[model samples]
Target: MSKFTSILARTFLQCRPMTNVSTKNMNMLSLMKSNSNPINRLAILSISDFNKRHKSSATSSLADKELATFLQDEIENETKSMETKATSPTFEGFNTELKDAKVILTKKSGKESFKVIFNVNNSLDNNSEEEYSEQKNVSDNKSNEDVELGSPISKPTYTIELEKNGQIMAFYCSFAEEGSYEDGNQSSPDSAGYSDLYRIDEISIYQNEYTDDSYSVTCDLLDEQMYEKLFNMLEDRGLGNEFASKLAEFSTAYEHKLYVNLLSKIKNFISS
Candidate 1:
C-alpha cells in the first residue's frame, strides 16, 4: 500500500487485475480514479446495481438554511454546489449536467448500490501560495527565499459507496504528486511524481469500513511510522493539542482531526 500512495491512479490499473480486491475490502479496484484537471466528474464502472434518491430544496427550514449559509460564507464565496439524481442511468449513458456533485446508480453482483459524488474543492493553489508565503517570509530573515515544493493536484471528486440505509461505505480519494505541476505551463504527471494527499497508499480505506476522507483510524490502527508521520504533520500546525484531545475520546474509534485540520483550514466541515 505504501507504493500506492506514491503513484498515479493510472498505475493502479497497470498491474493485472487481481482475483480479489487489491486492498483488503475496498471494492473500488477499477477506477479512472476520477480526474480533477479538466473538470470534476465521478463515473463508476463495473457496478452491477444501483438506485438513486434525489431531493432538491428550494425552500428550507431556518436551521437548514442557516447551515447552508454558513457553509457558503465559510468557503470565501465558494458555494460548493451539489446535485442529486433520482434514478439510475445507463452504462456510459448518464445525462446529468456536469456539476460539482451528483447522485447516480450502479450495479455489482446481483444487488443494486447507490453512489454520492462529493466534490472536494480544489485547494492546490491556495495551499501552495500559503505555504510558499510562509516559507518565503521565514527565509527573508535569514537571507533569501528557497521554497522547493510546487503545488499539488487536488482531488476534486469523491465517489462514495452508500449502503441501502444511506450509510457511507467507502470512497476513492486520488491525489497528485508535489512539484508534479507548475504555474502557467502545467503538464500531466502521468509518468512519475505522484502521491496521496491523505497518506493512505491504497484504494482501501482504513479497516475496510465506512469512513470519509475526513475520518482516519485510531492510533492503534496505524503503524509506528505512519503514526509518527501524521503526528509530526499535526505538530507543525500547532494542533498537537487538538490531535491529542481527539485521540483522548477513546470511544470515538475513528478520529478525523488530522485530515480535517489539513483539508479544511477555515472550517471543520466533516464533523459538521
Candidate 2:
C-alpha cells in the first residue's frame, strides 16, 4: 500500500469510533473499501480539499493542540481580571430573572408594577469603543485620566414597562455612549441628550393585554418639556444616570462571562 493510502486508512480507523463523522467522509471511506488504489483516484485533489475532508480527525492535529492551549490561556486570563457588578447579585428592589441572553427585572411600587428587559447579545462590541474613542477626541480632547469612564461599556437597548390597574405603558429605550455628542452640544434638540445615558425612543399604552396591533408613538414627536418629563419619570423609578452606568457595567461583565463560557465549550468540543 502507498504511504498516502496508509495514512488514509489510519485516519479512517481513528475516526471510525466517532459517531459524528460527516457523510462525505463516510462515503470516501466506503469508496476506499472497494477501490484498489484510492490514493491514485484522489491524487488530483488539492491539499486544502484533503484538510477540509478530514477536518474531524484534524481536531487531534498539532494546529488544534495549539488552539486549545491558546484558549486555555485566554480563559484563565479573562477569569482572573473578571469583576462582577453589584447588580449581578441583586438590583435594588427589582427581582431578576435571566432567560438565555435576556435579563428581565420586575418590581412593584404602590399600585404600579414595572418590568425592564434587556438582552446581552452583541451588547458589548469593540467597534463602538473605537467610535466612542474617536468622538471623545473630537468633542473634548480630554486625557484618559480626565475621563475615567474606562472603555465604553454596553449600549444595550432596554424595554421598560409600567402597569397600573388594567393599563400598561411601555417605553422603548437605548443607552448612548459617553462623549458621543454630535457638534459637541449635548443640549441641542437634535442630540439624544447628554452622553452616557439612556434615552426613550418610543412609548406605547395599551390595555393589560398586549398584541401585535398595539400602537406606539415615537418620542421624537414630543416637545422638549414633554421629553424631559418622561425621562424624569423614569429617573424617579431608579432608572436614572447612576442606574444606567451600573447597567452598562453589569451588562459588560455578564456578556464577558457568557463569552468565556462559549470559549470553554468550544475548547472542550475540539479536544474531544
Candidate 3:
C-alpha cells in the first residue's frame, strides 16, 4: 500500500468503533484498492465517513437552536407577568377612607424609610327617588330640624409630632383632608352634622431614631403640588359628594390611631 493509504487506514481504524461490522467493511474496502493506487481508495472512504458525521452534527445543532428559542420565549413571558403583578394596585380594605388605598414603605440600615402614597377616591349616587322622598319628608317636618342629620364631621386634617421617651419634641400640621361634598341631609341649618363628610386630602408619616437620651425625628407628607393634582383629577372624574366626605372622616380617625400606636411603640423601645 502507498504511504498515504497506510496513514488514512490507521486514522480510520483508531476513530471507528471496533466491531465485527466495521472490520468486515474495512476488509472489503482494502480488497477493492489497487495495489499501486491505494491512496485514492482511502481518500474516498475518509470523505464518505466525514459526510455522514457532518450531517449528524448539523441535525443536532438545529434541534438545540429550536429548544433554546422555545425556552427564551417562556422566560420572557414569565418576566412580563411578574412585572404586571408587582405594579398592579391591591385593595387594602373597604368602607373606610383608607380602604383600597395602597401603602408602600421601605427602610434600610442607617437610611430613612421611603414611603409612596396612592390616591383613593370613593363615590356614591344619591339621586334615586327613594332618597329624594326621604329628604323631602325630613325637610317638611319641623321637629327633625334640631336632630342631627347624617354623620359627625371631624376635621379631615392631621399634624405630625415627634415624641421621644414619652415626651413631645415638635409638632406641625402636615396633612389636611378636603371634603368632596357637603352633607345634604335635612336637619337644623346650623347643625355641624349637616357638614359631615369623609375626605382624606393627604397622608404624612413621622419617622424617628432614638438613642439613650436623644432622638432624631422627621416628618414626610405628600407634596402640595402633587396633592393638588390628585384633587383635580378626582374632581374631574366625578368623585364628589357626601359619601366621599364620610370616607375621609373614617380614614382620618383610623390613621390617627395608627400614628398613636407607632409612637407608643417607639416610646416603649426607648424606655427599655
What tens digits encode model 2's per-residue C-alpha lDDT throughout 1-272?
A: 99999999999997777578699998877767666475755663556587776885665587789989999998996676464333364578888888878989899999999998999997875666786687667547655455533344666888888999999999888765444544322223445533436677789999986689999988777886787788779889887777777777778777777877888998998789
Q: Is candidate 2 or candidate 3 better by lDDT?
A: 2
Q: Which sequence of candidate numbers ranks them by lDDT, best first?
A: 2, 3, 1
Per-residue lDDT tens digits for candidate 1, residues 98-134, read 2323223333322424343433344233555577677
User: Which 10 residues in a row give candidate 2 its minimum summed lDDT?
Assistant: 181-190
The global C-alpha lDDT for each of the candidates, from Candidate 1 onward, is 0.37, 0.75, 0.40
lDDT of 3 by residue, 1-272 (tens): 99999999999988997566687777775667553467877787799899999999899777766665655565554344334322322322222124333322222223222222223222112333345567556866967476323321223233222233444322221122233343321111233533313233333223353245553332224454554454444344333233244334444344334433444454444334
The reply for model 1, stretches above 4 Å from the true place, is 1-109, 112-116, 123-154, 157-159, 162-168, 172-176, 179-272
- Evaluation by lDDT, superior candidate among 1 and 3: 3
CA lDDT, candidate 1, residue 10? 63
After superposition on all C-alphas, the RMSD of every candidate to the true structure, in Å, is: 34.6, 13.4, 23.5
Model 2 TM-score, 2 decimals: 0.66
